[model samples]
Target chain A: MQLQYDIEGGNFTKAGFASSEIKKVLKQLNVDAATIKRIVVSSYEAEVNIVAHAYKGAVTVVIDHEKIVMQYQDEGPGIPDIEQAMVAGYSTASPEVREMGFGAGMGLPNIHKNADDLLIESEVNKGTLVTITIYLKQEGGQ
Target chain B: MQITELAKLTEAQVRCGNGLMHTEILYAAASDLMSDVLTIHHDGMVLLTGLANMQTIRTAEMSDIHCVVLLRNKKATPEMVELAAEHNIILLESPFTMFKACGVLFNAGVQSVY
Candidate 1:
């Protein structure tokens, strides 16, 4: 199954809705509870990043018998240095986002921890695209 | 501890999830940072924090956190209340500060998620 959602920037209220919807779809697919949790966490953090930093964004999620993939693309100030952004304590969030109890800079790290495979692409003046992949099979158990 | 017990121990008002009071909570952690809360996949956990916003509820929903105890009398926005109810996650407002709230719950036999 493939699902897509639009995310509005500067709108914290609507931020996690996409991931929540994805969670429901995953649940219906009978994905295990543990894998569902990882997808939710990984997708949610990526979704919030767009809401916090982008002008707008969209998420594409693909699920099948073997793995689930969530791809988030945003139109906003893209990351200049993905490495710096990956650092745990690094943050460039606005004061407003900080006040809401986010922007501690652990978002990407959390996603990294939860996802079996992650990829990011960005352009400084354009936007960013984040892809997260997690396998459904329990054999290799992450 | 039961969800009601966290409210009782911290002198909190159940702003939502009245039906959830019977749910058992086995672990907890306090933090105002939603990212921190999202770091772990929690089960049977009650999150204690001063942060009350739409993202807090969203964070709990994503992390599988069962309850959120807002410390220092922070107010949960209407959007938060609505979302919490929809997700079946409990929203709580405790009169005690974060330190006191965690301490009180700890003394009452609630295990920390550390």
Candidate 2:
């Protein structure tokens, strides 16, 4: 099953809707709890990034019996330094963003930790694409 | 401790998921910082924070937090309430300051995640 969500930038209130729906879908599908958690974490991190950093974006979720994949694409300022942004404590979010309980520099790192496979591609002054995959326990071959 | 007890102790308003208030919370962590909450790894704890936002609910859902209590008289937005409800998380609002709210919960047997 695949699901897509359009995220409006600067709309903090609507940020996590995609993740929540994904979680529900995963639960109804009866996936492993651990696998569900990984997907949820990754989806959430991506969703927040879309709301915080992007001008606007969409989140795509693909759930298979063996693994789950998530893709986040955004048209934004584009990260100038992927290496710096990957650091655990680096964040470009302003104080206003931090005030809402995010932008703590953990989004990307958390996404990386929770997903079995992570990929990020960005073009300066253009946009970004982040893809994450979490393999199911039954699919240990992953 | 149960979420019901924590709500009563903190004098928090149960905004949603009242039925789930019976859920047991084994630990508690109070922080407005998402990074701080992320560091704590309690599977079924109650999160107490003054920050009321969609990300707060998202953090709790990802971390397996059983419920959230917004302290310091902060009101949760409608979107936040809807998000918490969808996650099956109990959302509560308390007029007590963060410090006092944490103290009350601690006094009533809530322990930090660490």
Candidate 3:
């Protein structure tokens, strides 16, 4: 199954709607609870990032028997330093965003922790694309 | 603790999932940052924070969090209320500040730190 959603920039209120819907679909598919949770977390963080920082973006969710994939593409101020952005405590969000209790700098790190495989590509003046995958099979278990 | 007790303790109004007040919660986490909430390991937890928005409800849904306690007299959108209702998650509003609310709950045997 594949689902796509346009994330509205500067809309803090609607940040996670896409991921919320995808979570519902995953639940209906009877995916393992843990896997569903991980997907929701990673996808939501990515979605929030786009809405908070990007000029605009779209998120794609793809689910298969073996894995779930979420791709986030945004036409926004690209990350000037991917390595710096990936750090757990680094954030470029303004004070306004911090007032809302976000911009704690955990978005990318949390996404990486939840997804089984993660990749990101960006251009400083253009945009960013993030692809994250999570496998159905749990670690160290049959 | 029972959700009903939590509601009474915080002087909260239930906007949805009244039936779920019977649900028990073992731990609580208070944060407006969705990323922080996602980092902590919580199963059957209650989230107490001043942040009331659509994403807040969505975050609770994703984490399997059973209850949301909005502190400092914060308000939630109609859409947020509707979504929480649909998901069967308990929603409560409290006049207490975030610190006071969490402190009250903790004093009443609501375990924190998870």
Winning candidate number (lDDT): 1
Error of 3 at B114 (Å): 4.0
Interface RMSD of each: 0.7, 1.8, 1.6
lDDT score at residue A28, model 3, on the 0-100 scale: 81
Model 3, span A52-106: residue lDDT tens:
8898999988888788889999999999889999999999998777765678899
Q: Per-residue lDDT of A23-108 in model 2, one digit per residue for the tens?
A: 88877877767677778877887888888888999988887777788899999988888888989989999877888888889888
Q: Which ten residues in a row have the lowest lDDT in candidate 3 chain A?
A: A133-142
Cα lDDT for residue A121, candidate 1: 97
Predicted candidate 1 versus true structure: per-residue lDDT over B1-114, tens digit per residue: 898878888999998999989999989889988888888665889999988788889989988888998889888888889999999999999889988987888888888777
Q: Which CAPRI level is candidate 1?
A: high
Which of 2 and 3 is the better model by TM-score?
3
Q: DockQ for all models, in order? A: 0.91, 0.61, 0.67
What are the per-residue Cα lDDT tens digits for candidate 3 across B1-114? 899988999999998888788999989998887668878667878999888877788878878888999888988778989989988889999899888888888898888764
TM-score of chain B of each: 0.96, 0.95, 0.95
The runs of at least 3 residues in candidate 2 whose Cα sits more than 4 Å from the true structure, single-residue gaps closed, are A138-142, B38-40
Residue-by-residue lDDT tens digits, candidate 1, A29-86: 7777888899998998999899999999999988877898889999998999999999
| Decreasing lDDT order of the candidates | 1, 3, 2
Candidate 3's displacement at residue B41, Å, is 2.6
Question: Per-residue lDDT tens digits of candidate 2, residues B41-60?
Answer: 55778888888877788889
Error of 3 at B81 (Å): 1.2
| Superposed Cα RMSD, model 3 | 2.2
